[model samples]
Target: MNKVIDINADMGEGFGRYTIADDERLLDIVTSANVACGFHAGDPRIMGLTVEKALKNHVGIGAHPGFPDLIGFGRRDMSLTPLEIKTDVLYQIGALSAFVKASGGHLQHVSPHGRLGNLAVKNREYAQAIVEAVLSFDSSLIIITEPGELAVEAEKRGLKTAVQLFADRAYNDDRTLVSRKEPGAVIHNQETVLQRCLKMVLEGTVETVSGSEIEVDGNTLCVHGDTAGSVDLAKEIKATLIEAGVEVRKLEEWL
Candidate 1:
């Protein structure tokens, strides 16, 4: 049987009249969308419009919640308590769920955005808090998190989880993503991205930027909607996966 992988993209990050991400075209190529909730990078209008677009495209809708930092784009880390994080996450998910419901769609999953996602992967306490919030809000919603760390914890707690690996981000020898501020953290070459993705799905192994190979479980693959040439890259990746006989689908559909 051909191996299958889920392709997901972050979208709907624009706030008010200001646009930030390159999602307008990226949405067409992805099977699942991580739509920005109001706290991170969206307003009510933008959220509604994004859900509508995803719904029309038959894509799975997911809430993308982040720290309340529109200025830093939610990339800057904040020293927030677990309760604080949980509260904000609930609010963001609630906001996105309302919009998705209004559009006659349902939120299929929840993926924390920016620093929140990175932090959750590295911190067990923080990751648990996030999982708790999602369960408290709605246990049926899928939890999308970094493959090894957060996914393991969520599974232990009986929450359905999808392991998300970034095709555009460099990983450490341990399979953790390199800090975004570091040089060579983000992959710019399309061929390299394609090759890495192929290895992940076919071999279940990825070579880290430091020339170390680590086993990785790629339940869902993330392509940054804001990255330059992201739309083109997504299109190419999809075609390549199909050519390799790798199934490209949403997380729910794949399982």
Candidate 2:
């Protein structure tokens, strides 16, 4: 194989009786699961159950933390102090850790969700706060994020880090993800997404929203579960990678 990578998907985003992603199906395909903590979409029971399922599927479990906005699904930006961001992240990770431990699985990574994650790409304060929390809590836990302020902060703090590339989001010329409110922010067409992935992995390039092709960096790919046809997309992406001579491996096992 010419390359080794990890396939990750967000899951456990359903609350109460509602469920989002086809997590069971995804767990079998993806090498890692970025599970939602309670603040966003999951409840205690959901979190616990997600952890158990991920463990059963031999998938690495990662804490997917975001703003405490259940209604917005943590996709909207929130105003908060550095302390608030840091503490909120720590609290969320701790909660997920409990479930992972009880389920006999180790927490492998921390991936900030939605808005918080996007902002961390450029906002130094937000990036620093998240890295500090991760360092204090579990330095061994990799921070799966795009190549930006968050990854830079993690490196400075000497914490394990993994470069993350989104399979379903468009990139800006600045290399940051385009805002969700903007046009073409999320890529939905299956063939376009597949071609984009191939270019990103095999060619190290992605066409930005401004119609510019730029170099991209990443070893971990995230296929957002909430998007329509995500389960099928994840499966195709995995098969495509394997067919292209890329090994699909877990971040915890290989990184």
Candidate 3:
């Protein structure tokens, strides 16, 4: 069987009349979309349109829940109790679910956004809260994230998970992503990023920041929708995967 993988991107990050990424064009390339659910960057109008466009393009839809920090785009750190994180996540997912249902598309997964996602990596309390929120909503929802505490927590709760490798970020030797604060953390060269994606799928490994390659078990590739020339990059990566005999499918159909 051909190696199967899913390509996902964060979409619907714009609010009001403001626009972020070209989500419409992104839907054409990505197999799954992690639509922002208002608390972070998206609003009702953008969420509805994003889900509608993604379903029309045969792309799987997912809720991207984040901390309620629109100013920092959910990247900055914040203090919140376990109960707060759980309820915040539930509210955000519910908000996005409405849009998905309205468009006649089922929600395929839930991916915690930005700070919340980062905290869940090593924070057991945060990870458990996210898992609890997902279970409370839909136990079948696939938790899409990088391999970390969140992945372990989700599996513990009998929920499926899809591991995603970032195409434009640097990784540490331990399979953790290099911090954005560090230099050379985010790669801009499309060729290099494309090579990393291929390695993660074909060889199950990626070169770390220390110039060492670590084995990675990734079933999905995450493309940044808000970056410059990202639409073109997504298109190129999709074409490259197809040419390499990899099946780029939706997360729902597989893991």
Candidate 4:
């Protein structure tokens, strides 16, 4: 039997002063949601509403922490010490955790947003600090990260981790995502995205930009809810995975 995988999306990104990311429709199709904390794109009100929505929809909840770069929606990298990164991540997780708990919901994981996520994948120091903060805040929470780096680091640190793969992003020769600034980074074509995801989940491999196939582990798959056609893409991906007999579940269930 094919191993089950969880499908997650980044939601609750709109803030008090700014609105971005259409995520409500996409929520129904995804099993898990990573909500932004204030530092990224959410405010208290947004977080509360997001928690309620997720609970109503029976979706798994997570904290989506990122650097304090509102102008870039935490997509831009920032220079910060390891301690600073730890502090900010902890603060964000704590803030989101409150809303989830108050709503009688549990936070299932922590998926760092944007640049911080990319950094965590390669930098052991940053990964350790973030994993430590996550474990400290809630021992039960899972850390969703790339298969090799952050996931490995988190597991080594005795924190539960999920190897998360991206279905809508292109990979470089090393399996890292091609920079978004590049021309062909985000896969907007639905048919292509579907084919790529099928191969990744069923074949357990992906073709990198260098035209070489590499083995990859996909415990969970993420489709950015804020992206164009996000709702449609998520629905199609879920349908395809289910049709292939791959159980799509929340991270909590898998853990």
Highest-scoring model, lDDT:
3
Q: Which stretches of candidate 2 lie over 4 Å from their true place?
A: none
Per residue, candidate 4 scores C-alpha lDDT tens digits across 28-136 of: 8889999999886888999999889989989999999999998887888788888998899999999998999899988888999999998999888888789878877
Off by over 4 Å in 4: none
**Least accurate 10 contiguous residues by lDDT in model 2:** 1-10
Clashes of each: 0, 0, 0, 0
Worst 10 residues of 1 by lDDT: 145-154
Question: Which segments of candidate 1 are over 4 A away from where they belong?
Answer: none
Q: How would the candidate models be sorted by lDDT, starting from the highest?
A: 3, 2, 1, 4
What is candidate 1's TM-score against the reference? 0.96
lDDT of each: 0.87, 0.91, 0.92, 0.87
Q: Write the per-residue lDDT of candidate 3 for residues 74-182, one digit (tens) a residue.
A: 9999999999999999999999999888888899999889988998988999999999999999998999988889999999889999988899999998888888889
What is the model-wide C-alpha lDDT for candidate 1?
0.87
Better of 1 and 2 by lDDT: 2
Q: For every model shown, what is its TM-score relative to the native structure?
A: 0.96, 0.97, 0.98, 0.96
Error of 4 at 58 (Å): 1.1
Evaluate residue 242 in candidate 4 and report its C-alpha lDDT on the 0 to 100 scale.
Answer: 90
lDDT of 1 by residue, 1-255 (tens): 878888999889888988866676777888999999977688989989989999998899999999999889899989999899889999899989998888888889999999999889888877888888898898888999886556777898888988887888999987788998899999999999999999888898999988989999868889987778888999999898889998888877765
